[model samples]
Target: MKLTASILLTTFLSHVWSFNGELAELECPDDCDCHYFRVNWVTDCSDSNLTRIPYNELSPNVYVLDLNDNFIKEVEPFPPDFKVRRLQLSANLMSELKKESFAGLNYLIDTDFSYNQIRRVDIDAFDDSAGLINLELQGNPLDDVEGPFVAVKSLLYLDISNCSLKRLNDRFFENVTHLATLDLSDNPLFVINNNVFDPLSSLETLKMNNCNLTRIADNAFSALRNLKNLELSGNNLYETNWGVVLENLILLEYIDLRGSGLTHLPDGMFDNNQYLRVLILAENNLAGLNIQQTIGKLQNLDTLDLSDCNLTLPLSEDAFANATKIRNLYLSGNKLFASDLLLALSPLTNLHKLSLSNCGLSHLPDTFDKFKSLQELDISHNPLNDAFVKLLAPLETLEYLNMGYSNLSHLAPDSFSKMTNMRRLILSGNDINNLEAGLFGNLTHLESLELNFCGLRRPLNATLFFNNFTYTDLTELQLAGNPLRVSKTGPLLPKQLSRLQTLDLSNCNLTFLPPEAFYHTRNITNLILSGNHFTSPNDLKFLELLPMLEILDLRYNNLTTFSPKELTLNPNVEKLKLIGNPWRCDCSVANLWDWANLEKGNLGILEGSTLTQEHVSVGKTKRKKLLICNYDTGTQPFTIVMNKTVPGRRPFLNPQRTLTATNRTWAKYVRESGCEQQPSLKRVVRSADGYVSVISEDGIKMRYAKHGPNTWSAAAINAAVVYVTLMAIIGVAFLLTKKRRAAVRMVVTADKRN
Candidate 1:
């Protein structure tokens, strides 16, 4: 009896397992892949070359379905009781939406039909979508939109922007009472009626920018009492009384009126907006704004932007005197001098960030001492030099400074010694040729330094961070776009820079790497050395010591070979960039291929070689590693591969024995030359991989094939021909002299006989 019971139990368990397996397979559709998360399955059918929705193949367990980038024309009725909560049908050819299109999706909450041919949405299209909270109809030609979302009363966010909307009325938002955000930008609306937004009383943010609006009615925003942010920028508004229009928005905290032809800010414009914190008036013709009369009322203001305004009147002390709570002020792209700016900002003691970039400031005024609490300052695109930089000594709390594009050619020693608390410094886009040691020694807490686009010829000494036995806390340093060359002595990094994490030296015109180049930056993980002139394997021998390096960029260099012995990678390296190089695909580059394909390193080599007989141009060789080896012999080029038996499409490897021999020959030749070329014997380096490097007496190496159309080979042949022609000419001259002597002796003998 017990045995019988066991057999019955086994049968039941097997049946249950089979039923569960069927359910799991049923949820995954044939047209899409399903992935299960915490609650339900997400079906990804995007970019699947789909022409129509496989409604019958979809299971009810699918919650989120992505049908983006398809060729479907219309939104067919969904399956009955469809459990999909979100449906994406963007980038399709659908033109219109019918009323019963989404009738069966009872649980649908969001729908995206953007980037389609949608021209109209029926008023009752969303009648069954009472639970729909978000709907996107952007990038369509729905110009005469009247009212279609009356049934979508649960909507919270609506984006009908960029639909060529010309006008809006109260009927458009009749039932959207609970909407919190509305975006109607990129339209052609000329006038805004007062009661259009009256139904959306709970709206908090409204964006109507770039609408080509000409005028706003007197009480246009009087209905939105709870609105906190309003953007009316990029309009054709002119001579509009904003004070009366914005009088009812008592809860407004942010406003943007930029790119509007508002010549002036009328008096008492912001008097009612006591809680306003951010006000942007950029890119406007605000030459008549009396700062004291227009902006003095907002006592709670914290940030104000007035950039690109052609100010005609000089700012006085009374400007911004009432808005003492302002913490960030921007007056960039103006013609204000340092003295006028100082006078305007002398009363803003609570300011923390100030941008006076492109103000033509040549010097700092004495009134600049008022920025006691400032932590960030931008004085870029000016004419400030070392003298003006010294004027910033009073800002003890300053941490970030930008002085790029300022024509600063020199930085005197101890110029920035007073900014002890500074953490980041930007001096890019300058004509600085050199920086002395200890120029930033006092900034022991500095973290990042940028000196790109400067005419630097050599690396700065390590003493810049030698601050009384305490190493500088610098973590990032960028010296790109300079001309730091390789020195004969050794590498140019300080051993004490243990905290450094990132160093960018790209486009610096470097030629070589002295063995211990990066021995100091033990903690460095990212090193960018692209767009330089490093050509030989000897230039990368310093990478072996960097055990913590995670990313190494060697792109756009003149490198022709890569050997594991010279370019040893750390085990932690994850990415290696080697694009834009004249990679010679032969036994010489075998180690690099092995390293890239290794399983332990898991290195991602960007744009390595693929087997191809056709040679591509250097610039177009991205994602292709092809070369024209032995091409000038008037023969068809063959694909270089590791073995002859490998399939045409499979990757092959070079023999390790041949690869090691090629490397040994190269090293032996380099060592025999004493790492220096001999002056007497013209050094000719022959590689077993089928090329020759001719090193001149002056220690310059140029490569040429044994029999190919290389510039170096052509030049060498021409030189040999010139030497042979000169020797032949000298031999003929000697014979002529001997003949002349014999003729003269005969003439003397005949005279003696007479």
Candidate 2:
């Protein structure tokens, strides 16, 4: 019932908007927030540490006013018929905008003094407000645009980007002649002379990106005749003449010129942009030009991004012979071959997305009978094999196919029998193992199937999705790094995956799941058994036959306790990933301390037990949250309690840190930090304020805090003797570069139990 008529029309518009008692007698001020939105009344004193401007007389239908981030230094004067229509004083400490500074906001239409320390903007400051139409003086220092927009003549969007603007004289937009979107990007303005945007004749979107621009003088955009999107990307614009900067953008439809180092793109430079539809010259240095004579007269060009232009132009067949109506073509990081990608994609016969990924393509010459309106094809990380899957089985209007990593191994059973409108198949990092059974039995609209790192080790044959007839719109199945085992002629998935909804068998060393694995996958909802080897929580009874399981990733599994009968299997499992498990905190982890402090499930732990180098620099930093186990029976035999969070130290010899929570108290500071028997304290480095750094097994020879029995603290023994004399001069320059490594094989075994 349309959510019960959207909850009875939201309780009859919250009782007809409380019959506007003027926003219910508008008193919300002391640290503001007054509601009533649709058609006026919104106060909200942003970040309430406000230092002013809580101006009076609001609710005359208070039209949206949010005095942004406080300590406001001055944007006062409001008190008279204050009719605000959108005004957010951004990050404040306002410095100037004097003259009638928004005199009564004549229904001010949008004004955000961006991140302010604004260095002045007097010039009749919007001359008694003439319906200000979007004005944000970006992070101001304003290197003189003189007379700050001489009265925003119906200003339609203006953001003096970064505001260190170096040039732009021709009366700097004279009087904001109906400006329509102008962001002087970053601003150093190297050059862009002539008619300097002839008073923005209705300038329609122009962002001088990065602005180190080399040149663009001639009639500088010929009066932006209703310019339609132009961003001169991060510029040095290698000798940019760009045919007098694109002749006069005949209603130019999008142009990004990414990274601009342009090696060549002049000839007819987009012959009068025949309605140029999206053209991004990606990371430019157009290797040796002739890439379709730089956008072959853009005959209504539809999306063309020359990816990482290191292109060595060999592509012939008239390159893109007049860009035959290009429909999405990004030559991913080009270095083409295979008949120069079939003569640069057989003239993009209306290509519907074609990306020759990492173009060192191993094959694909038959060029899918001229891409019959190709519908998404990315030859991922190309080195391709499996004869590029029978050369994309003649892409019968291919519906998204990405041969991921592309060193594909086997799939010959009619290799995707003429891609029956395949709906999304990415054979991930292919080394594909086995599967010949009606190979994708005529891909019945295959939904989302990614054979992630296919090294498939048997057992997954429900004819790939219930054979004997037909029914395979397989919903999102990524046999993640396949090694799908448990084979005594039993389980490895496919027990009728009744429309499986995302089932990624992560790092498959998975130790078993026979009991009807996902019993007909009752529409399994996101179940990625992360880095497997499931070690009980009763191995989660194949997720209580998945009652639409809602995300359960058992991250790096070996589970130590999530037991209370695996928390009743699917109490609407709402995301649970026990991070790199080694969990066993005794007494059966007190039944997961109130189900890991439930807030509707989202638990992931790896709190601590060893793995440090900041946990092997986990994913190069950022992934942290997942710590639970509390078990504290006030001491004696049950004490896996940790509260005074730890992980400290950092003088930066780069032993890595960043794990927080500390206030001492971990069992009375580890028995007052005596570091129990320091036989060169074999590595502790603990600290929750209770300190501990017993390290002495030749870590460049050191010792600090040596755990509290006091002695180290002369600035921690002079920062561990300047990080052990800079790791003893980089360990004697890495043992003299490993003794002039000319023939350095090894044979230095010694520790026979030390």
Candidate 3:
């Protein structure tokens, strides 16, 4: 019996040891968390304050590793037999990838080194036995696509986007023959040599979008025989001759030349490209469709986008006469008149989607009934009216229609009754003052409705009317930018729209919302309440009732103050827009800074928070002070008087005493002040010095001086008087004086002579 018991006890002890061993092998390290998913073990060691990998304590069966969102500065050596297949080392401070960094990862198939500070990679950095299939090095400081892909022959997908690569050598992609997809988009490659793509003949997808390429040299892409997709959009190729450059790309299926600065295409531009299916030439300077013959050659083309091409001239009817195979056409922003232009496109019966937004089309003719096969029509930004509704009434097959900004003020009861196949209708930006009860009752297949900014003054009631329609197919409803004021109006929405994932009521003048407003919308992922008058804190309770609200836009409101306690009430609010508000910035607002810092400072959200609180503090104060001082303060009091008497000096102040009596010797003082004073003239007696003095009625004395010396003055005065008297008497005494003087002279002479 003792021997049998010992055998059983030994067997039980062996079983216990083996079970404990398996559990220990499946457990994660003390610093990490581990879980078993299928046959692979996943471990997350992020933010564990780990300076290096604890290889000894880590489970041996771990195949997936996550070291993202950590402060790991360097990559330590891995375990000898570590078999990780996918590794994530993003959001770290790794500056360089050395030769021995990924030595032991012989089975790593996917690796993400994005969002790191890696500036350079040494040659043979990834020269290991690992079979890497997908490598993502985006969001790094890598300036060139070198070194990291030295021996990665099995790499099928590689993304080097946003890496500032200027020039690429032929050998850069020589060994990447097995690479099926390569993304070099968003680089600064201003100059590309002809042989830059010579080694990428086996590449199926090559994206060089927004690379700033001004010119494409001959034979630049002549070696890409198997290339299926090529994107050269957003370049500076203004005068590119596509005949010589893209003539050999017969196997190319998709080509994006949007924003490539090509105004017009030459004849036979795409004559050689018979297999091309999609062509994107939107946002260019092409004023007119002068390439009718060239576009006619593309018989296999299915999609053609010419939006925002500045097409001011009317489209020729023959432009799309041969393009009957096209299914989708985008002609928005051409400022086209719908009546004249749609007449030209009446022949395209196979067109499935048509966009004519911002074309200045005020009305459409009844001839629009020709496009019976069109499933989607975007006629927004046109001044459409109730009369224009008849034009679209024949389009019974339209599944989606966008009539926003159509200036439609009213809707006839049977306006949309014929559109039984319509799934989505966007009537936003219309002057719709009211919607009849059964306006959309015939649209039983409608799934989405957008009535935002319709200027609806009254709230939508009549729940019984909507119950008659099939609301189970409704998925999204947008009534934002209206004047739905009451809070109780929220529950008035159709209750059968339980599948609604998005609801927008932003800018609806909603001061408050009832809890039942979102009771049926608990599954909503996006809710918008921006641009409204939700000033009270209690209004935020509507958001808490939504357990799955993901995005909320509260822009342009009057939320002046916020607290951390208010924000904690809604934990699932991922995206919040609080821009354009009157938020107060003070010490109490510092909690927002802390929250933003903790959230890694997302720019869009932090922009709204910081704009009103921090950025608008000093600016608002300065603006207020400017407003106060802008008014005109009556008429500015003038202390310097005009047309008034002088204040102090009495002599100068009195107009009568302006000149003294002694000064009358120089001149007379004219009384020019008023008509009260009159002047008195008086004669004066002359002295020996020929001086004259005068006295006036007011006792004013005056003196006058002679014109010569003292002796000459008296003699001249006496001689003047004598001369005047003698001159008067000389007329009669002249003859007697002259005779008497002569006789006297003669008697004196005769007596003297005798």
Candidate 4:
């Protein structure tokens, strides 16, 4: 089961001055930089080492002001007409929030004052900033009296968690009545007074998780009628009967009570939560599970997570008799016997995703076919061998299957012939070395196949994808950690993987690859060939066959220098992984170094800002490994010649890595790494008269190299052009000579007459 949570981790953002719509440029404060992000004018002043907020110097129309991680100690009032919408002031040194600190910022909607040394917050601090909607006061040591944000009556979201809050006074939220979400997690709040949260009648989500909370008055949350999501996980709620505490919360939809050290879930604890859809009771020390009382009363429960509850089975056949509507059930990390587990789960035919990993099972019940609606199944970390092959073939509806480290040894050739609907299959960490011909031929819809570390000993051949003519839809294939090396006389990759986009063959103990190794893989865009034994970039000649290749990973190879000339040949490739190699920052790498500077603006696109801290570009790089130069050239001034022009003819922006690009780290290395090139060697020409001589552009002789590859070169077109140009020059000379002769004859006749 996948759990996804989005926590807003506000980071430091340096600002530049620009309007949102027209993006008109304006002078920014010396301590700030601003840019237009999405639909707002964000001016980030973070990490600027400023002692105070640049309120007077900021743009009047700035919508977002980020001053995080600065040396500011006080919150000064903004300009009277400041229209800032989101203000971030995390990691500051302020000790107290004084009144009128944010007086005139009527347009401020979201603000963060987290991680400050604030020991007190005056109740009137937010009286003038009534328009603020979301407030964060986390990571503060606010031991002062409560009722701090009583003035932010319009606040809708508040995160006062992790503030070392021991207790909240009765009037803590006296004026904030419209709050929809409150996070009080990661605090030392030990007790809850009666009717403390009774004022938040409109609150929809309340999170008091991980607060070391031991006691709570029954009336503490007695008035929150609209509360829908109650997450009280990671707390000590063992002292109270949570059923009585949550008896009035009728609108609760999702409850996470994981790791609360409860021995049993009292009957009807969630009986009043008729709208509950998901219930998580994982990591609890429950003595015995009475599912009929835990989930039987809920008609809308769709997901139940009882993983790691130390649940053992001999469960009654009717344990989940009334909870048949649950579709996603997670029983992983439990030690249920295979037979008893399958028997208990047999009634839930509507299950779509079931995770039984680490359940110590050696077989898959053929009865799984009864769950015709099941799509995703994970049985990893079990001892199930090939005994479960045919048992799983009946589940035609399964789309995703992960059987990693299941002690699998071998399977029949047509083991998965019936699972044509499978989209992703992971069988990594097994001993199934040899694959039969047409093994995956029937899985036409498979998109991702991972077989890493499967103990394959022989070089791959066509039989791996043999007769799989319709398997072109596979986009990702990870065969790393296997010795799938190349042999001189072995078979090449089949053309069936023509449409494959990403292929990983890393750590494959590969030393050499023939030039035509991947000649059939034309559309692969991402290729991982890292952790190999390639000593030179020339060993990557097979890349020429991958015209559509873009991202190439060559890390941990025995490479010394990657010639920029190779990069010039492969223009489509952009993001390169050359880390973990002994890279010499010299003439052989200078052009690539310069090229990477121009290209690095494309990396780190996961963030809104690119790596360059300059202009944004398209085609973001996905690799996170930073390329470092291993050989540090000393500060000695040694002369080295650089090529005036790169060999290939292409535009300056794209293929040519020789373009002048800025590298902020260039000062650390010697610029004299640019060295001179050897003089060009004269080609040997074998003349038609049987004598060898130096080559000329004239159309008589054929040139030979010091080595031969049993291949011939064609010069038909170039030879024809050279011959035509020579003929035209001779014709022009003959015409001029004829005219001079005629003039001389006329002069001689005239002299004879005299």
Candidate 5:
């Protein structure tokens, strides 16, 4: 009886398992793949050659369903009693969402239909669905948000970013009273109506970044009294009329208007915002700011981002005189001259961070000694020469110093000697041609050093003079954009910097690389060597040394072919940028093409074949065409020589005459010389043979050869006859003269005889 009972129990367990399996497989269409746990059923029918959602086969108990990455066009029907809480149908071919498409999904809480071809959302689509909490319709062609969502009282987060939203309607968010976050970024929203935010009373965060908004209507945020965070960054608002617009947001705490077209802040702009804490107005066109009157009003202001504001003048002495509680001040990308501006910020003795980059400042005044409490100071993109280095030598309290792009041609021997608390120092984009051996000897506390684009022609071989040093202190180093040609020196960098996380050597004229170039930097995470001329075949072996490298940027190099062996050397590389290389698109490079095709997501080729020519002619004429290498095998190679003629040509011969010979005699002499006879023979035969015969010697020779003896006989007879006739004529002329003289005497004698 016990054996029988065991058998029965075994049978019953088998039946139960089979039943559960069948239930899990139920309601799943034959074309879809489904997996189910106890309460949730996950179906993946995406890209399975389906035309529409198989709603009839959908399980009723499914809570999360993903139909994304498919070719589904329409939503026909769904399970009536389904209890779906989340549905993701992104990246599909759906063009429209009808009102009744999601009718039966009463318990749906989240819906993501992003990255679709959706052009419109019909009204009343989710009118009766009250359980909806989050709706993501981003990455669509939606021009307007006029659908009926008034019934979704539980909606808290709505993302409509990257849409075609041009104008914000007043009643667009009337039904979303409980919305806590609304993201409308990356839209063409140029206009914000006065009553745009009137209905969003419970909104805590509203993002309108990159909306191209040129104007914010007065009282636009008057009704959004409960808004705590407002992001209107990347707009065209040149002026900020805070008294008419922002004064009504009594509960506003954070505001990011950075990258806006604001040139200056009004005197009393923040006078009414008593609870405001964080304000980001960076990347604007502000040349100067005078906030003395309003500083006292913003007692709660903590973080102020004024970077890239084109501030040319120093801060007024009274600007932040009353703002004693301010902490973070981002003033990078300004036109600061020196540390004299520290006098204006002296009242804020508790300030922690300050950025003054791109400010045309060459030196820091000794007044920086006043900011003993300052922790971070970004003085990059200025003209900080050796003078500024001395000025910064005394700041012992500084923890982070960014002096990038400062045109710093030199560094004093002990410039950073007293900066004991310095942890991070950025000196990129400068003219620093050299670094003294012990330049950073005193910066024992330094953790990160960035010297990219510093015009460093040689390699760095400095050692920390301080005896209290270890391999775990320095964590990051960026030496990109330097003209360090020999890569063998790369390994000479302090091996004690074992904790380095990043090393950027891009744009360096590195032609050859040694095997141990990066052998010591085992803990490096990011390695960038883009824009370099790494022509050696063994250059790729450098990757083998960086075992921990995760991100590698090898873009814009001389890597003609991709090698899988080289890539496999760094198996941990997560992000690799191989673009901008002259990758041969031929059979020899077939492996590279295959790899690129297989890993299209990770690799990127330059837009066109050859590197873009940057130095085009500056005149109005069109650019001349460049002869790039031909990839087609059938095309023949040709060369073009641009032999530009000189602006003027020299005269063929000098006009001044060296001899007094007339034109006739010169011609006769040229003919005689060209007859191919000796110069003496030509002079001797000139009178006898006649000038014409000597000149036409070539013609006479051809005539004699053709006519043979007849030609020579005719010439000889004619010459002899002419010579005899000339002698007879001379004799007759002489006798005539004698007869005339005798006749004269005879006439005299005859006259006497007569």
Candidate 6:
């Protein structure tokens, strides 16, 4: 139903939109697409191969002018009269901002000029649009160019990062006093004098990270009296004596000074910052800090990060004595002994999140019973045993835990029964060969479970797998890198996971799956079965089982032809990967013309993604589609015998796109290409046009041109008739199944083989 409705809506919208010369009542440039969206005229000239802005042809009432991702060299003066409030000109080729370039954009409120080659800007370029509130000039080559921001005094946000700025005049920010946020990161400025930022008194957030700075004046940030958030990460601030410059910013609320060369903080480092809440000093030499005097004195601080500081064992018991309000602490990269943890963090009764990952601990301290509110914990990469699971019982309120990469081979039954509020569990990278029955019976609220690379081999029955998971809330289950394909003794999935939306069984070496494999997981929307060995058209039986599946990943599998009618597929599932297999684009491919409205230029191969959250190796650079044909038979002329004309009626996002006999014929394509011939079809009628048309209740059709030579034998005729009859039966069943399933319109890997 969702797929049908989406197609109907796309068809409707496509008809209502046309890009020629006018949009609604406004005139548009020939190279631009003008859309009357909501109450605004949005002119999109991005990636239109524009060499320069079409100042005269653009609509005067364009509310949002998008000229990004173009090759335009410069911005000319705006049209004499315009209402463009936002202008986007990023990823362009402009090298300089000439004077009076934007002299007429009075209504401009926000503008972006990032990712350009701009190295200079006239001081008065934006002088006429002084009311502009936000300006972005990042990813440009403006090393020392200044005075461009002298105008736009009402600017509230300005980003000038990655511009190689090495120096700033004493009065660089002389104007823009109303600026509330400024990002000057990725610059090469070694020092900041006190007089540079005197004009920006209203600034609230300042980011100067990744700059090679060795020293800064003590009063450099004094002008930013109201600054609330300061980011100075990735700077060498040791020469400045623990950055004495930060002492003047009394109203600071969040400070990110991670990776700074800090061995110890002065006793009065944060004395004036009473409102500080999040202090991130991670990746610094924090082992030398007197926690009792520095961080411990911040009574209102709630979050502190001291990870990778090489903290030793047996920290002073009064370490966080006065920091009782701290709620989130991270010491992930430091190796802290289990016995020393309690004494160090026992005072933080309000602690809610703690991360001690990669801490080289073999056990956990009798985790402080006072942490009644701790909700998230990460102790991964530790050599913890089955007994360590018992230590976490005190954290009954823990909702998220990452015990992945631990040294446990077995899951102690009922070990997690006390963590009733558990919502997510990550036990990846272990050797837990079998899951203990009823081990998760108490996790009534669990939603996501990841057991990737756990040496799991499944011949387990669904009934016994989740015998006591009374709750039906588990939505995501990742079982990548496990061998679940030997032989199914029972259903592959459990009923407790009926509501599961995402299931990743990738790289499982699966050859074939039974029709009932997904019988219990009918509600699954995203199914990943990539990196398996499914070799025949009969392997498509899974499609008949998953009615609600939306995205299916079958890359890197041993599959060849994809006849949608072989085994009916849920029209809701759109992408079927046929990459990495020897695709014989024979007459069977023509079968796709009737079911798949294979867009002429769209030959499948679509871009794939690499970002994974469940640690599944989906490193496929591009999702393979059924495109490439065997070069030997690349032009092998074949005849497609159609019975009758069945006009394609699938109304989709592209209403103007349709497959017809007049558009293209398979025989015509074969004779035109210069590929080596394999002659998959007989030569007697090979020259005849191969046209295929299909779709019927239970009947099949084969209509060929009468231009072929009359060289048919009795045996050939019998074989042709038998083949057509068998296909007719399959076609009838296909339509019946699809019609019953859809109750609407029945229209709709990765490897080296493609």
Clashing pairs in 4: 14-44, 15-33, 15-34, 15-44, 16-33, 16-34, 640-674, 640-675, 641-675, 641-676
Q: lDDT of each structure?
A: 0.70, 0.66, 0.65, 0.69, 0.64, 0.69
lDDT of candidate 4 at residue 239, scale 0 to 100: 79
The RMSD (Cα, Å) of candidate 2 is 22.7
Q: Rank the candidates by TM-score, best first.
A: 4, 6, 1, 3, 5, 2
Compose the digit string of candidate 3's lDDT tens values, residues 265-341: 77877877888889988888988666367776788889988888887667777778877888898988777765556
Task: Give the deviation of candidate 6 from the true structure as CA RMSD.
Answer: 18.1
Clashes of each: 1, 2, 0, 10, 3, 12
Error of 2 at 341 (Å): 9.7
Which scores higher on lDDT, 2 or 5?
Answer: 2
Q: Candidate 1 — which residues are off by over 4 angstroms?
A: 1-49, 54-64, 78-85, 128-130, 148-150, 457-460, 467-472, 483-492, 505-517, 526-754
Model 6 segments more than 4 A misplaced? 1-50, 53-67, 146-148, 241-244, 459-469, 481-491, 506-515, 526-544, 547-754
C-alpha RMSD between model 1 and the true structure? 29.5
- How many backbone clashes are present in model 5? 3
- Candidate 1 contains a number of clashing pairs equal to 1
TM-score, candidate 3, is 0.64
Question: What C-alpha lDDT, on a 0 to 100 scale, does residue 115 get in candidate 4?
Answer: 84
Task: Pick the winner on lDDT between candidates 1 and 3.
Answer: 1
TM-score per model over all chains: 0.68, 0.33, 0.64, 0.70, 0.62, 0.69
Q: What is the lDDT of residue 579 in candidate 1?
A: 67
| Candidate with best TM-score | 4
Quote the positional error of residue 747 for candidate 3 in Å. Answer: 99
Kindly list the per-residue Cα lDDT of model 2 for residues 1-754, writing each as its tens digit.
3464456556544433443111244534533535444324566666546688756535555766767667888765777777777777777888888866677667777777776888768766767678877787776776466533556788888887877878878877888888888888887888888977887888889888888988888678898878999998989877667877788888989989898777777778878878889999988888887866667767788888888788876878887888788889898888888776777677778789988888887777776788788899888888876656676677788899887877766777788877888888887777767676778777878888888767777646776543654345767888877776564433446644467788788887887676566666667778888888888766667676777676778877877666535546565665566666765444344334224322221122213211123311211211223333332234433222332322211011212222222222111222222222222223433322335544443454234443452523233343444445555655676667677553343323233334
List pairs with backbone clashes in candidate 2: 604-626, 605-626
543 in model 4: Cα distance from truth in Å?
6.3
Clashing pairs in 1: 609-625
Cα shift from native, residue 240, model 5 (Å): 7.6
Candidates arranged by lDDT, highest first = 1, 4, 6, 2, 3, 5
5 or 6: which has the higher TM-score?
6
Against the correct fold, how does model 6 do in TM-score? 0.69
